[model samples]
Target: MHSVQNTLYVMTPNAYAHLDNATVRIEVERETKLRVPLHHIGALVCFGNVLVSPALMHRLADEGKSLVLLDNSGRFKARLEGPVSGNILLRQAQHRAALDTEFALTAARAMVAGKLRNSRSVLQRGARESADPGEAETLTSAADALAASLRAVPGAADLDTLRGIEGEAARGYFAALNLVVKPQARQSFALDGRTRRPPRDRFNALISFLYSMLMNDCRSAAESVGLDPQLGFLHAVRPGRAALALDLQEEFRSVFADRLALTLINRGQINAKDFDEREGGAVMLNDQGRRQVVTAWQERKQEEITHPLSENKMPLGLLPFVQARIFARTLRGDMQGYLPYLAK
Candidate 1:
């Protein structure tokens, strides 16, 4: 099992990160603000105008840690890492599998099934906990619809058909998600379907930020296990896109990112005042909001869960790595097929 390590996020604008022997030091306005031992860090993620010294970048690469850059709104910009240490044979197998329609379809079906099943779990749990009879009925109806989608996964004739099923299921899921927010907080955090890029509403903005971090983890997981991040079974291949990472992200979106976003909103950890409305009607979390989310994200990762397959307790943060290894095994023919992480 891969142990969960810390990801140091540099969110302060104009903050400078440099190497100080075995430590990573952060300075602002020419004064040291924080220092963390390099060994404790698995990755360094910088949001917005954070600066990283060249020496620190080199060290990070040499140590096999990743450095990710994102805009203030958490849009991906770039990633830096060490030389490819992944097995060429594993990647070759991944490529060959991508070209095999049967293999690709099977993998895609598994991924979609995992996503729909996890999403249904979320809706059903919300339905059970909802105090309002009408809200509970709405959630239950959505959950039943997702169950129907899950049933259709095996019968999907092609990738396009499978994608259609997933897309429709997602629409209903998001529509029902609006009811999950506490009634008192609904005015502030109500989700208006699912919008991205600039995320028109507050809920969309919060989840988009969480999704960016999840994408980074998924990409890193694929790279660590010698899988090709660009070639994927479900998502279409495109230049500059980590298709495999996006593929892996599907199963975790509801169980990880969406659930956390709801928790923060319902528990009042995040509020309307935590976001900013830019001139163009774009909504985003302010610095203070980002800090609150980051702290919650870190804490959430530390919570332990037992794997449905391995039955071993592991940190939630390691799910991506575990699933990536499972994917590699399937590509290598060691496993019959890809088994997604089913959240219990």
Candidate 2:
């Protein structure tokens, strides 16, 4: 299995990257700011306006590392990788399963089960922490709704039925997400529901940014295991969509991103002032806000958690890679079935 390692993020707008004596050198305003050995990094993620020298890019490819480019607000722009890794047979198995209705349904059920279970956990935690009786009741009810959805997954007869169950659980989860925010901060950070394609609120913007980060991590994990990240059973194939990566992302969206976003807002590390409203009523994080969120995100990735299935403690950053490896094993017919990551 591929191991998880450090992911270098360059969020500064003017930062330039190049190779200097087998190390990645970062410079801004013509002054060297940081230097990291290439061997220590798993990926180099650069945000808006960061320039990567050809020499550095070639060296990273040679070292089997990834170079992911994102806009300032954490939108995925592009990704550069070395030669594809992993066994060809594994990918062939993945493709065959993707086109099989039974295989797709099984895999989708595992993924959506993980999502609902984690979403329920988030709501349960919120209910426990909430002082307001009404808010606590609402959160508990949502958690129950998610639990019902989880029970319904195995009974889903078709793709559309499974999607309907997933959508209902998501709506119930998001409705309770507002209670995750502290009462005093609700006016500034109320989350009505999930929104994308230019999020309409600060809460949605934060969720989008976090989802983008998770997507990149999932893509890297899939590539590391030699799986085609673009071909997935849960998500339909579409032009330029990383379907497999997205399918993997569903499990972690609640446990990782949603939890962190709540921590940031409830703790007052992020506030309304950190967002900017653009034309057409779109909302997004400003530069300072992005930096704060990214730094916190990196630190959060370092935190360790125990895997329920493997029963091993590992860094949070390794979760996606571990799940990908397990999924690959299932596709290869080495395992009986896929086991989604379950939060305790």
Candidate 3:
């Protein structure tokens, strides 16, 4: 399996991409800039006004590579992918399993439980490492509350009730997010309970960008296992929503994005100066800030971690794909139950 997590992000505006047989060529100002073999690319993310040739598109589709387009501000615009792989039988199984009441509830519980546990782990680590005793106490209390919610996940009777439990846990987790930031940067990087849509604060802006990147990874993972990204047990499906990807991403938010965001801020790799405030009080990352975060995120993905369920060590970038395969096995009746990744 060509499981390399090589995502080529074309950030330069007006960069041209084309296919030279099995090679992907990039041109800027009528001069060749970069060339990569097709097998090396898992996904291509184009930002701003980059142009992709038809030949390249054909090659990407044939090889099952995803092409995602994002605006300059790092918001998702669209994605292009080839025909769905895997047997229709697998998809049928997925569709049926999603609609089955018992199966749906089971899957939902696993996702919520995994998210709560991972979130609590993040808080516990912060509590242990934070210099401020008051902040440590706050984080510890929030972690205990999230732990309680994790225990309640299995007993929820319906999807709505399960959603309520998950929401409460998430709220509790974010409520303590401010305590995770160092006191030196607390005034600038303070999180006011997870605001979004415009991301009023600098902290929320960075978090939203990290989440977009994580969601893309989950989408690719779900597709690789022949599952429909739009259908999900934990999230309600609607037009233009990759519900399953969102559901899968919840388990990784704390361990992946949240930790990285905190590291960037506390270590001063990114600060208030990296953010730009618009007239409407919307905060966003400047281009330099975006590049810094992308570089850090790519490095973070390369770090090794042990899988709690499989007891196998792997790069953090490959976690989503591993979990997707596990979910597929459960849906196909090969596995007795689905186990969501819980960070240790």
Among all candidates shown, the one with the greatest TM-score: 1
Per-prediction TM-score: 0.97, 0.96, 0.94
- Winner on lDDT between 1 and 3 is 1
Residue pairs in clash, model 3: none
Decreasing lDDT order of the candidates: 1, 2, 3
Q: After superposition, how far is residue 279 of candidate 1 from its true place, in Å?
A: 2.0
Q: Model 2, stretches more than 4 Å misplaced?
A: 1-4
Model 1 per-residue lDDT tens digits across residues 164-254: 9999999999999989888999988878899996899999999999999899899989998999999999999999999999999999999
RMSD of each: 2.2, 2.5, 2.4
Candidates 2 and 3, the one with greater lDDT: 2
> Which should have the higher lDDT, number 1 or number 2?
1
TM-score attained by model 2: 0.96
Q: Candidate 1, which segments miss by more than 4 Å at Cα?
A: 1-4
lDDT of 2 by residue, 1-344 (tens): 01135788887778899999888889988998888887888789998899999999998888888889999779999989788778899999999988889988999999999999988999999999889999899999889889989999999998889989999889878877998899889899877688898898999999899999999999988988899999988888898999999999999999999999999999999999899999998899998888888888887888999998878999898999999999999998888889999888
Among all windows of 10 consecutive residues in model 2, the one with the lowest summed lDDT is 1-10
**Best of the two (1, 3) by TM-score:** 1
Clashing pairs in 1: none
Task: Please give the distance, in angstroms, between residue 205's alpha carbon in candidate 2 and its true position after superposition.
Answer: 0.8
TM-score of candidate 1 against the unseen true structure: 0.97
Q: Mark the regions of model 3 whose C-alpha exceeds 4 Å error after superposition.
A: 1-4
